[model samples]
Target: MAPPRNSAVKSARPVLAPLSIGNATPSNGGTPFRKPILTKAQRKAAPASGGIRRYQKSTELLIPKESFKRVVTSTVSDASKAHPMRIGKEALESLQEAAENRLVKTFEAAQLLAIHAKRQEIQQEDMKMIRRYQKSTELLIPAAPFERVVRELAQDLMSDILFTKDALKAIHVEAEDVLVKIFEKAQAFAIHAKRVTITDKDIQLAVKEILQ
Candidate 1:
């Protein structure tokens, strides 16, 4: 007839009340537990000093996607006798990647040319030389006075950096060697493409292959 021992032990244990937000009060008589709200000025200033701010490299496309797509569409239409062609998103992206890569290759070639002449800044002649060199196997040489142009451009591009005359000459020699290698690879690419004319695309492909 007596109650079980377990029941007696349970009844003896102390009970705690559930916490209620409305009933709770701050220790310092301030507002009860609530998130701090920022003013407009405070929000604006937060990024200046707050550790919460984050920075990342830009992800914007170098080539305008819409414009490139339009150009591609136009080219395809003209080539296919005005037939409608819908390029998939993946294909467009791939084409854009290739075009961007080609542009980078062209710039790199020009830069190499400039450096080969001991110039830090790329000139119009440098670009022209790269184009000419890519198109043919002929010995392509810049007509500019190499030493003067190199000194001027080097000073312009590296105003703060110091380069000894000997160092500049060494860089020029190294750059020329690299340029010859690039030209040879580009020629090979043109041959592989089965084209007598070495186009910019061939140069780009060659650069890609060489890099790989």
Candidate 2:
């Protein structure tokens, strides 16, 4: 008598052994993944976002991120006050992005300037050409007149102290920086007012808001 078909089929099937936790392996032959080991420099330079990475051979950053952000906020605030207009979130973000791009390009141009001067370290003078610009022909103040005004202001503040050549040059540079920023803000005022020409009031308001 032959065994029942069901009993024969069961006998022919292979019996599997139970897997132990220590000896269990994945179905595929690949090894288990582990975290990557980072070098000291990599660890130090890691960004908080972990999004995009920019690597520089030198440890120095072209501009401090926080300082750049502060400048952008201040610029936006000044523009708002000059125009009595509000900026949306998207516009604010766009301004920040544009500012960042400008900063990078400015630094790159400054680096080229430094290289042309055969300097490994970029100095303030190397960045002068990158920063130098005239917003309006009519607003251009003659260098001599600007220097004289700075001298007068210094004398008034310091009880007529003698100014050295370097001191005078530094004062002029600082004054130019201040005036340029004010003029740029005033241009926004003119545009907001829908006028082609910037009036004295625009300049005054710009200076007042910036000072405040």
Candidate 3:
């Protein structure tokens, strides 16, 4: 019995070459090769620092969050004493933000006032000026409060006086004008003394001059 020569022929098996670190390539051509990730210590050793380092906050804000929160709580508590209402967290936060903005603007206004007046330092007198604050609303005493104060003062001089609401309003308006004038005069005295804050003596002198 004879066998076919083609049946005895064997297929050649391909041999894989040993992989060298320098010349080794990935099995899949479609997938790109990626570099090994470094640890924190290795990251610091890298030429470009922080290549694999975790991110962290660099610094804190100028005003502490807890302190600001406490301030808001105190303000809310004080307001609640008079109004007797509960303030939500959102409302309290809004109030805190508004207060911060107002204070920042106030300091900026003082800086501008000082620059305009050619002064190196901002004074209490600078804050006293309505123009410096750029406040649209006028600061005025209420007629009722003004009437009550006037009635109390009258006890030392004359009594049995009744004031109409209109009369009391007029008096309040006039008194506000006079008070502003007196304050300005006191500020002038402070300026003359080269003082930033107006002293009691300066106020007394201003009042005396106004009465005279």
Q: Highest lDDT among the candidates is held by which one?
A: 1
Q: By lDDT, is 1 or 2 better? A: 1
Over 1-212, each residue of candidate 2 has an lDDT whose tens digit, in order, gives 99657877878889774443444434444444446899997876564443323343444445565675677667777878866655566775666667666877677567656766776668988666556742233324666787788778877899757877787667767767798789778867885786656799999999999899
For model 1, what is the error of residue 92's alpha carbon versus the real structure, in angstroms, after optimal superposition? 0.6
Error of 2 at 145 (Å): 3.5
Q: Stretches of candidate 2 above 4 Å error? A: 1-143, 153-159
Task: Using TM-score, give the best candidate's number.
Answer: 3
lDDT of 1 by residue, 2-28 (tens): 966787788788876443467665544
Q: After superposition, how far is residue 23 of candidate 3 from its true place, in Å?
A: 80
User: lDDT of each structure?
Assistant: 0.71, 0.68, 0.69
TM-score of 2: 0.34
Candidate 2's displacement at residue 185, Å, is 0.7
lDDT for each residue of candidate 3 in 159-179, tens digit (9 for 90 to 100)? 877777787777787888789
Cα-based TM-score, every candidate: 0.35, 0.34, 0.37
Error of 2 at 48 (Å): 40
Report the alpha-carbon TM-score of model 3 versus the true structure.
0.37
Clashes of each: 0, 0, 0
